[model samples]
Target: MIEESGRVVSIEEGAVWVETLRRSTCSACSANAGCGQGLMEKLGVGQRRGYVRALTDLQLAVGDGVVIGIREDLLLRSSLQVYLLPLLGLFAGAMLAQWLALPEAFVILLALGGFFAVWWRVRGCSRRGVDDPAMQPVVLRAQLAVCAMPVEDR
Candidate 1:
């Protein structure tokens, strides 16, 4: 399970809306100083904050801090859907276009068309909730200011 801390924004019966900081991994690598990812991070190219609708069993309230978790398997599958399929489509489309001896411009267009076609299908499948339960995040536990352990034992 992958976990992150978030603060509850709203409660709706069985779920809670939480807002968390969108962490960037660019800084973790030694090559970040000259990498395109580091440049994008410096420019704030992506979202700074992220929202999650997490299923919860606890009595959570607005403004409460909580830990949300997502299954690693689900994350892996989602990564593939977002990254791999389109790549395969691009290669297949390019090869088909070459085999047919199409013009250079048409080849590029067909490749892009193939990528978008697969992307559109992925979007539709997600909207139809093909694997929502596995993809959805779940609230793990409430965050506490202090741990239950006694202090000054050292």
Candidate 2:
């Protein structure tokens, strides 16, 4: 359950739209004068993004920073789908090629080419900040982590 904070920019029933800040610790570091991180941060201004999500708590409002987690099950399932689905497609295509008496080398090359093309497309989407939708029943792990902390710490 990775969590990051954003400003609650708006709200609707069971939802809060938030704008996440592009936070880089390098911005405030004394060594920023010598670091590439600061240089990239400066170049990547406006990297911040907005996303709307369901909120059980109605008390939160605009201008308030809220933390959100990319749901774990959704993350895991999406990774599996991205990695495995194309491989399955390649296998099916290869089987057809084999039955059609295509040369073994050609079949193998087809599988490899298909795999690379799919992987490349998925990578491009990920790099562009395109989000995969979450499966239902998102259990909030970060909230549970906070609750499970010992009483003395609280």
Candidate 3:
């Protein structure tokens, strides 16, 4: 259950809009006073980005915690369509071209297309966390702490 928080920017016609915050952990840095990462977070403070999604039958308020995701079946189908099929197509095309004495240019183009197709799909899929309005990783695991608490001597 990934989670991210946002202020509902709008609700209209079976859709919800939200303005989200980027997740950065500059506050805990030991050198925050001189760190570039800390500076960026501070400079970008209070900035908001918008996300819009079709409202589902489930009741959701404008300010609700909206966790969106690619459903498991959708993900599975995408993996097959985007990755495996493209690879198989490329290999089969390359071999068939060799066997049938097809032009080298034709074979190269098909193989390149297949490779690009897979590259594009993988890039988008991995960044689902950045672009998807519904899926948030923060809700799943943010607070399993490390290190022991300090003891107060009596």
Best by lDDT: 1
lDDT (Cα, tens digit) per residue for candidate 3, span 1-154: 2245554556655455655666577888889889887887889863557564533444455566554433565556556866786687678667767677879997887777756766676667767755454442222211223569899999
Candidate 1 ranges beyond 4 A from true positions? 32-47, 147-154
Indicate which candidate wins on TM-score.
1
- Cα TM-score of candidate 3: 0.42
Q: Per-residue lDDT for 31-131 in model 1, tens only? A: 99989988998798854788899998899889999999999998898889989988888877888898899999989988988888888988887788743
Candidate lDDT (C-alpha), each:
0.88, 0.65, 0.59
For candidate 1, report its TM-score. Answer: 0.82
Per-residue error (Å), model 3, residue 42: 14
Off by over 4 Å in 2: 22-42, 103-154
Tell me the tens digit of each residue's lDDT in model 2 across 36-125: 878888888636675646444446656665667667766787788688867876886688678888999989977777677777777776
> Candidate 2: how large is its RMSD?
10.2
Candidate 2 is scored at a TM of 0.50
Q: Pull out the clashing pairs in model 1.
A: none
TM-score per candidate, in order? 0.82, 0.50, 0.42
